[model samples]
Target chain A: MMTNPGNKVTQGQFSFLPDLTDEQISAQIKYALKNHWAVSVEYTDDPHPRNTYWEMYGNPMFDLKDPAGILLEVNNCRNALPNMYVRVTAFDSTKGWEAPRMSFIVNRPPNEPGFRLLRQERDGRSQGYSIVPYATDRPEGERS
Target chain B: MLDAIAKGTAAPDESVDLQAEFEASNIDEVMDKLDRELVGLKPIKTRIREIAALLLVDRLRRKFGLTSGAPTLHMNFTGNPGTGKTTVALRMAEILHRLGYVREGHMVAVTRDDLVGQYVGHTAPKTREVIKRAMGGVLFIDEAYYLYKPENERDYGQESIEILLQCMENNRDDLVVILAGYKNKMDRFFDSNPGMRSRIAHHLDFPDYGVSELKSIAEIMLGEQNYRLSEAAAKALEEYLPIRMRLPHFSNARSVRNGLDRARLRQANRLFASRNRVLTKTDLITIEESDIRGSRVFAEGKLEGEPETKAR
Candidate 1:
């Protein structure tokens, strides 16, 4: 999938960069493997800032040794969900906090619609602002 | 285009990233909440700050590549009933979560009955299920000493303890087990289950509130509910707390809360009886001298239904 650079949602580590090269992605995957981190691919049609949990493509690749194998899985996810967002996450278990230490966007749709900021005035001079994804607000079939 | 993009068009290290929006807020807010919510347990408060600070320092060190180890986050809270042990434990969970030590940062409080099943072959599944539910948060076992019943041969508490010990060691990265109970019973619990003691990283002792502290706690409680105590009412509480503290089944803060509840009931009845008169807002909010029916006052012969208004 391809995306307009300006409309691409900025998320994950290194999201400000253009889509990563295979070599660079492989390097990070290798690093995760070296640290015994379980690598997993997650995809989501929504990339809202507050959306923390993404739909995991499958179970974590815990026993994977070669980065190419994970790369294939990532590519397959990108192919199947061409219009959705895909990311590779590495979960490090050595630390007592079982959380994803590294996650980076690997794929995006061809036409990435950005987000909108909504503000509401509260009691007196107070106000609250919420960031809502324009893509998510659109009907599923019309999301592109 | 895909082939060209995959070849070498982008560099991994050459990029800016969005500033993560979900970075946890300052741990000071959690400490401030503890201070605002909890009344008086200076020792417990100090211990919590010390532990939070140490964990923060350790995290900073690891970030700077100075040192790295899996620091145990589990704790042991030993205290009397209603001494704010559960309150402190909940606050500590929030602090740990805010500091990035715990993922979910919530607590799942349970007792012996929640963990150990009544019959054989059921304890493991039950314990594991509870542990699984508490995977991303703190699992607080209140009155943890009750878990073990060495006197009762059929008690499955030890089996549950064994399963918990395994999970405590294996799933430590995701789970925190806090065993809390009375001081002496907890000591004996640790002595009996030696594995549990070694796994606990922090130990906090919640001392019973002094008379003055209990008075302040009651005052704070009343203040929150928009009820003010008169001077005589305050004096009554000061005298009543120490007496209650010496008695059996006398919970520290809980007793004060109960005393306040009784006073509120008396105030309501007093106001209801005077409902015929033109009453100001002040009349409804103040706890009068006559309304300070502490157990001491009830024990002694006191005339009730007296029409006296002495507002301080």
Candidate 2:
């Protein structure tokens, strides 16, 4: 399968994969629900790794026994943050588990302007480097 | 230290091309990654290349029916904290996996507390459990010298060590146990545990990163977070290193990471204090000189690393 390295949103599982269809998303939700994992929806204008604390759409739908409710919320987030990055997370309620059990990108902006690897040769063969996100050069709201 | 990559046999009259085998092994890609990700561990890198070359030669030897038993892959990675020992170990696992020395290239990093339990009849299971998880891959014991505590006559650490030694001997083919810690301490550990020393075929010492190397690591961290230092600010960071190193508890790369994080915070505070003005893209992304100068180290005309903050 052909893959675009630039558009590859690497935050979560199955991210290098193409956008998941509603059926696939729903299937994943069902799996999480079956395992008693709390499924929450979050979206962000910034997809940077350091800025992963995405604004949650609503509190985690921990008690929503039905998967359709989450599907509806995810669609709403997609509609609201159309130009931003939106993702879904499944958190295990088991004690001492701080990390999300599963997470995946649900929606992404069409124009995914990726980060450029900026290398500056300092002294000799050793190089100094920085990650420059192209889109962030523009203001937050103005970024695609 | 691997013995199997090119397995089975070539035809009686056929020749095996060394170049072809190297290309097929994908070990070069692993080596490339090691070079890119790790900053300054020259001896460790050379040892890895030597080991890989030896394994490649062993495969060729096998094709000619000059067979030898699987070599012991156990190792001792000694250096100071934050000296890329774990990073290099991870790469070593990938190399081993790609070259058919292991089933999975994943690394299981553990400490003494993880392997040795507090009470009686607990350490064997704990150590064995860690070993089981580390099967088909590499087991990295950070500060492994802690596992040998001879001060107490009846310490549980020895049980863990004994179990580990058994696993290292029996599962030489599938498992790789790497003992890692400070150089002098590791040397002492070996003197006490001659069995471990004898079993270990290779010892790779990770050297501490210099000021420039630490600065480069900080730059890479900055890049990952989509931030950059103004030219003067970068200079300030360079100046900050030597002063910081003179202080206590300065972990090489890790301290640099914390320093960058604090610098970013100061930048945020500076930007917020002057929020009335219209800020440009550079204003937001660039960490200016004042941001780095805000560090308490700068306020100290004489004192460095005194843990006192400059009260605004």
Candidate 3:
């Protein structure tokens, strides 16, 4: 799940897997396509620290023509995140599906870690996309 | 004979008859049977369980001189038509009865016609009869707002509404009333009857099915009819459905069922045209892409790219 600082993700938003690398996200997409498995992804534009989950179940429909621009026909999605903008991180050629990757910027949030915080536009702003660490076992100081 | 009579505890067989008492009770068995028949509606099921718990707690409290009389529950179901409102209401009646809330589990379903009589002088009896039937169980009124339509200046519907209000108040202990309709319509209905609104404590909203949900529903229907959809066909159908599902009516599960029926017919026609007397699994089971076709016109009876017709 993706959460941000300002907006609140409603019950109709997509519930995406959190803190995944681009490689991992791609691998999941490939696996889903091969197995014909449906997946749920969370997408959010809200800058709130807490994340909300909205469910969407469908196989990935990949469009290779536009690599950087990830677009798929969502079979069923909750109304909370209607017409939500998202970027895809992974693709499986065999299964014809893709999964959104972590660190994908929405509404011009920078992808770099230290640079993200510096790029903050105004008061209560951060420079880059501040990625939330997912591992619970790791101590707060140990996380990047 | 005197010696035998004097012996108060003669044998183990002379003790309390536990086996006979166990055989006489049937509450647990009835609940188990009902549970198996009720499917889907997990949230509603949880709510029902919660109500049952409250009722039990209230009963115990009363028995221990801590509480009052029977507790009445009110529930509102908002969903598209044929999404199992009436079916669930029927099951609820049985569950409530088995839980000892009411005497019998009989359910009475009504529309505006059943409540509001045709002419002047006929409204009260009609309303009363509906109340009489739903006394001990549930009165599930579909589109309940039509009871207050403004068309009739005499407005006999108001008479029916008054009677219904009285019945609900007087028979609160034994009867459960459920009003169901579209979300906006139901809100308006509630607004019209402030007294009825105050009594309804529970509200359950059922969302419209998305394309994938519709696909799953379609697949379930196909399986029930001993048929299936080819992979490509299924994907195509799913893609096509969402594009057509812009309208509220198009997104309904019932509409998906209708589409499946049409697709089945198309498949049957193709098979018959081939002059094959024997239908194989490949022929009858899988729904091919050819079996289904896209509609050029939208649900509102307008061509996809056509200009709107101006009103005269």
Top candidate by lDDT: 2
lDDT (0-100) at residue B233 of candidate 2? 86
lDDT of 2 at A144: 67
**Candidate 2 vs 3: which has more TM-score:** 2
Backbone clash pairs for candidate 2 read: A130-B223, A131-B223
For residues B17-118, could you state the per-residue lDDT of candidate 2 as single tens digits? 889889999898989988887777788889898889888888787866777987788999988878878878888888998887876667889999999998
Candidate 3 off by > 4 Å? A1-144, B1-45, B59-66, B294-312
- Per-residue lDDT tens digits for candidate 1, residues B1-312, read 323323434343333221221223477777888888787888888888787777766654444344566688788999888998888778877887877777667788999988999788888767766775576578899999999987986889999999889988877777788889999999998999899899887888888888888887888899999999888777766666665666568888998888788888888888898888998888888897777753453453223432332322
Please tell me which predicted candidate would have the highest TM-score against the true structure: 2
Q: What TM-score against the true fold does each predicted structure earn?
A: 0.61, 0.64, 0.54
Model 2 chain A weakest lDDT span, ten residues long = A61-70
lDDT of model 3 at position A28: 43
DockQ, prediction 1 = 0.02
Candidate 1: where are CA atoms >4 Å away? A1-144, B1-25, B294-312
Q: What class would a CAPRI assessor give candidate 1's docking?
A: incorrect
Clash pairs, model 1 backbone = A2-A110, A96-B173
DockQ of 3: 0.00
